[model samples]
Each structure stands twice: as C-alpha cells, then as structure tokens.
Target: MKLGIIKLSVLITSVLLLAFQPAGKKPIKVYLIGDSTMSIKDTRKYPETGWGMPFAHFFDEKVAVDNRAKNGRSTKTFLSENLWQPVLNQLKEGDWVFIQFGHNDESPEKVGRYTTPTEYKTNLTRYITESRSKGANPVLLTPVARRSFDASGKIQETHGEYSDLARAVAREQQVPLIDMDKKTQQLLQEFGPEHSKLLFLQLKPGEHPNYPNGVDDNTHFSELGARLVAQLVLAEVKAQNLPLAERIYKPDPK
Candidate 1:
C-alpha cells in the first residue's frame, strides 16, 4: 500500500510540474509582398541584395519574415496569378502582411502590367479587406524611390499617382502606411547624386564576373543600400508602434 501511495505521489508531482512548465510561444509571421526592390535575389545577383533579405534577419526568431515580393509583379498581376491566395489561406490571427506594389503598376508603358489608378486602389482595398477577414493586419507601403536626380542635384518624385493612391487606400482602410518612396527619396537626397551611386547596382565593366558588360542600375539596390532601406522600414515599424516591433531583435546592453 505504501509503494502504491508513493507511485501516486510521484505521478501527481510529475503532472503538476508539466502543467506549470512555460508554454511554447507561437511564432508571428510578417509577410512582405512587393516588387524587385523587396524580393529575394538569385545567387548570380550576389552584391545586389533586396531589402527583404535584410529585413528577415532584423526580427527575433519568434517573428518569421516571409518575403513574397517578386521581380516585376504589380498588385493586379499578383492577384490574377493567384499569388495572394496562398498567403491568404495561410494567414492566422495576428500575422502581418506588408503590401507594397507601385513600380510595375505605374509603368503604363508596360501594357502587360500597367494597372490604372482606379484598379490600383481597388486591388489594394481587396488586399486590406481579405487580410483583415482572415484576422491578419495589412500594412500598405508606397514604392521605394528610384535614384533619379535633376542636373541641379535635387531628387525627383518618380512614383507620381501610384504613391498617392497607396496613401489613399491606407487612409480609407485604416491600415498602417509606410511611405517608402518619400523616405528613400529623402535618403538619396542626403547622399546626393554622385554619392548615392554607392547604394545602387553601379558596376564597372570587368569589375564583376556576373555582369561582364557592367550595370548602371539606379533601381536595384546593392547590399549596403538594401540594409539601409531595411533599417528605414524598421525605424518606421518602431515609430508606428506596430505590435510586431516588439519582436525586433535588439542587442543586449554591453
């Protein structure tokens, strides 16, 4: 009888300890949906990194950054191609979807991808509505700026109507807005015309094997530029006091 009593006591203790153990935390996911500026690059595009790549590492392990941003997808194509559906299906409560699509949408010259301002607003609204329906928060971001400067060394607004449309959607939907276009343009202005080249894919011929003829791309970002841009986004996240900011990886004090 004493042996049986001791066995029962052990079992009870075990159960109590197990019950008191801290529950494992469910990871929060932050989805990034945008264009080449935020998409992951191929190994061949080595020094040319995307802001999403660096943004992924800025968060703690409890926050998973899933970058769904592609090379040339506008909001219209992303929806029609069924890219947004998968993300919609996977979304759970408290997950975040960062939606940014203006570059390709603004390119009226590209008939295949040109999304009119009305269509842009409608698409953005659909994203916000659907994401909310699934209990996920959707953040709208304007397109990142291109490194364009007039001869007078002043930065230009390249996004035009699309940026304004994104702002309008954010306001209508009450979603968080990150004006990446304006922010990046400010960053470029600070660097000036000549110095800003360091932030882009400005390669000299024969300098890198990937681009034998060299590249003078002002749209795509170099690794340094991508990180800086990611930092800007992170700063905005903190400034906006988004719940995900709590998951950002902060170093311990020395």
Candidate 2:
C-alpha cells in the first residue's frame, strides 16, 4: 500500500508541475500598408530599397512583420483592388496596422489614384475603424518626404494637403501618428542639397546596369536611405512606447 501511495504521489507531483509550467509567448504581427516607399522592391530594382524591407529586421522572432504595401498604390487603389481585405482577414487580436498613403493620392496628374482630401480622410478613418473592430491598433504615418529642393536649397513641401489630412485623421480617430514626412524633410534639410543626393536614387550613366542611361530619381530611396528611414520609424515606435516596441531586437549587454 505504501509503494502504491508513493507512485500516486509522484504522478500527482508531475501533473502539478506540468500544470504550473509557463505558457509560450503569443506571436504578435505588424502589418504594413502603404505605397512603393514602404514596399519590398523587385530584384531588378537593386539599390532602390524600401523602408519596410529593413523595418522587418528590427523585431524579435516573436513579432512578424507582414508588409503588404505595393508600388503606385494609393488609398483608393489599395481598397478598390481589395488589398486591404486580405490584411483585415489575417489580423488577429492585438495585431498592429501601419497605414501610410498620401504620395500617390495627392498627385493630381494621376487622375486614377488621386483621392480628394475628404476621401483621403474617410479612407484613413475606415482603416482605423476596421482595425479597432478587430481589436488591432492602427498607426497613421504621413507620406515620407520627397527629396525636392529649390535653387536656394530649401526643402520643398511636396505632399501639400495630404499630409495635413493624415494628421487630421489621426487626431479625429485618436490614433498614433508618425510624421514621417516632417521627419524625412528634416533629415534632408540637415543633409543639404548636394549631400542629400546620396540618400536618393541618383546614379551616373552606366553606373548601374539596371539603368544604363543612369537615373536621377529623387523620390525613391537608395539602400542606405531606406535603412535610415526605417531606423527613424523604429525610433518613433520606441518614443511612442508602442506595444510593438517591446519586441524590438536589442543587443545583449557586452
């Protein structure tokens, strides 16, 4: 009887220990929805990297970064093409959605993508509302600044009313706002006109095989520029004390 009792006690102890074991950490996902500036670049694009590419590496394994941003996609096209639905479907409770769409929306030349200020505000609100409904947080970011400079070398405001619209939406919805446009413009100003060229897709003729005639695009980011911009966004995340900040990859003490 004593032997049987001892066996029973051991079994009970094992069960108790198993029951008290620590649970595994739940995985958190961050969904990025924006334009080409934040989208992954094609292999042919080479040095024209996007900020989202490096943004994914800043997080720990427990965090998943799903960048669904596409090239030339404005708020209207993003929704019209039903891209947002897939993201909404996959979002679990506690997920985060970063919404940035103003570059293409503000271009009057692009009639199809151009969204009026009212429509832009409504679109942003819809994204925030849907995200909240799914128990997910939505962060609004103004479009990253274009590298435009006047003859006097002052940074120009390229986004116009769209950036303000995003700010208004963030205010109305009580959502977190990252003024990427302002931040990047400040970065450009500090770099000055000549030096700022390094941050963009400026290339000499035949310098890169991708563009034999060479390219001098200022709006797109080079690899270095993309990484810098991603770092800026990460800094904002930390400054805001966002929940995702906890998943940031920090180095162990030396």
Candidate 3:
C-alpha cells in the first residue's frame, strides 16, 4: 500500500514538472528589412500596398511579422539611419530576418540610397553575420522586379547585377535565398504586360481620392499585387521547408 502511494506521488510530481516545462510554441518574430517594395504603406495610400503588409497575415498567431522596410530606402540608408540596431537588439534564437534590397540601391541617380555592388555585398554579409550571431536565421531575397517589358511584351530583367550580387552573398554565406526578382519576372510573364498593369498602382484620374490626378507608379504594388507576392513568398517558404513554414496558417478544407 505504501509503495502504491509513493508511486502515485512520483507520478504527480512528474506531471507537475512536465506542466511547468518551457513551452515549445514560443512566439517567433520574422523581421523584414529592405525598401519600399516591402514596406507597409500609409492609410492614405490605400490600395498601394506593400508585399510585407500582406505577408504579415500568412502566419499563425504564434508568429509576428515585423516589417521594418521603408520607402525609398536601401541597405546604405537603412543602416545609416540606425534602423537595423533596434531589430538587432530584439532578435532572439529561432527568429528570422528576410533581407531584400536593390531598387534605389541600384540607381546611382538616388544620391543618398545608391549602394555600389561591392558595398551592397558587404552590407548583405553584415546582415547575415549579425543575424546569425543572434542565433536567428537570415534569408536573402533578390529584389522583386520592376515593371518593364520589351516590344514583344516579354518582361525584362530589371535588377541586373544587384540581383546577382545578392545571389553571390547568399551562396557565400550559405543563407536561404528566395530569388524574388526572377520569381516576380516569371509572374509578370504569366500575367503578360497589359494584364500585369492590374498588379501595379495604375489608377485613372479621379479614381482614388488620394491620387486625385491619378498615379502610374510601377515600383510599388497594388492590393492584388501585394497579396500575390506575399503568397509567392509563402509558397517559397514551404518549398524551402523552413521551420517557420510549420507556423503558416492553414485553413480547414471543410
């Protein structure tokens, strides 16, 4: 009878200990760092959405997508403005950092934002190294494509060497890479040029309250475009079989 009581107590103690064990489902944060293509737009901007905005919804409650990308910023400006420090400070193990750039970085015309190819590579390396130092995973994505088409309506490669440089860094650092530039180019090709305009901020005059006269911006994405890109990223995440993929929100088929 005493042995039975002792065994019962031991079992209770074991259950108690197991109950107090640290939870394996601790919430994770995915930090998005880059340019306007991925930044959250102001409410006034309405339909002009950023892919990161829609991306925030793809994960379950156990994940938080913190998009730190800003308009007209590049690797150079993002670091110089001290944007990366706050993210670095908050990083924890099992977190992720998705880094995408180019756009303004490739344009020498953009005085403050242009990051030379060498500097771009160095900056990407720094992001990878620093992110890894925190035990966080770092993903490098070549910038998404700009809307451009040739006479035959074939989408052209707009990122050029910057995308290649990003690829080189990913290869050398052994980081996960989502080739968004190539992926987005294919997406555009699938949509074709005229239909592709549906993905951009192509509003007619007086169509939207904000852009009263109308806007024909190609770099930023419309609502449909943003959601599509976000879905594409999620698909790539699943394809890569990332740990975070398990947190992706899966709806009931029923």
For model 1, residues 1-254, the per-residue Cα lDDT tens digits are 99999999999999999999998666989999888999999999978988999999988878899999999999999998888999999999999999999989999898878999999999999999999999999999999999999999999999998999999999998999999999999999999999999999999999999999899999999999999999999999999999888889998899
Candidate 1 at residue 98, lDDT? 95
In candidate 1, which residue ranges exceed 4 Å CA deviation? 1-24
Candidate 3: clashing pairs of residues:
none
Clashes of each: 0, 0, 0
The regions of model 2 sitting more than 4 angstroms off are 1-22
Model 1 TM-score on a 0 to 1 scale: 0.93
The worst-scoring run of ten residues by lDDT in candidate 2 lies at: 21-30
Q: Across residues 124-216, which tens digit of lDDT does each residue of candidate 2 receive?
A: 999999999999999999999999999999999999889999999999999999999999999999999999989888999999999888899
What's model 3's overall lDDT?
Answer: 0.94
RMSD of each: 2.0, 2.3, 3.3
Q: Where's the lowest-lDDT run of ten residues in candidate 1?
A: 23-32
Best by TM-score: 1
TM-score, structure 3 vs. true:
0.92
TM-score of each: 0.93, 0.92, 0.92
lDDT, residue 251, candidate 2: 79
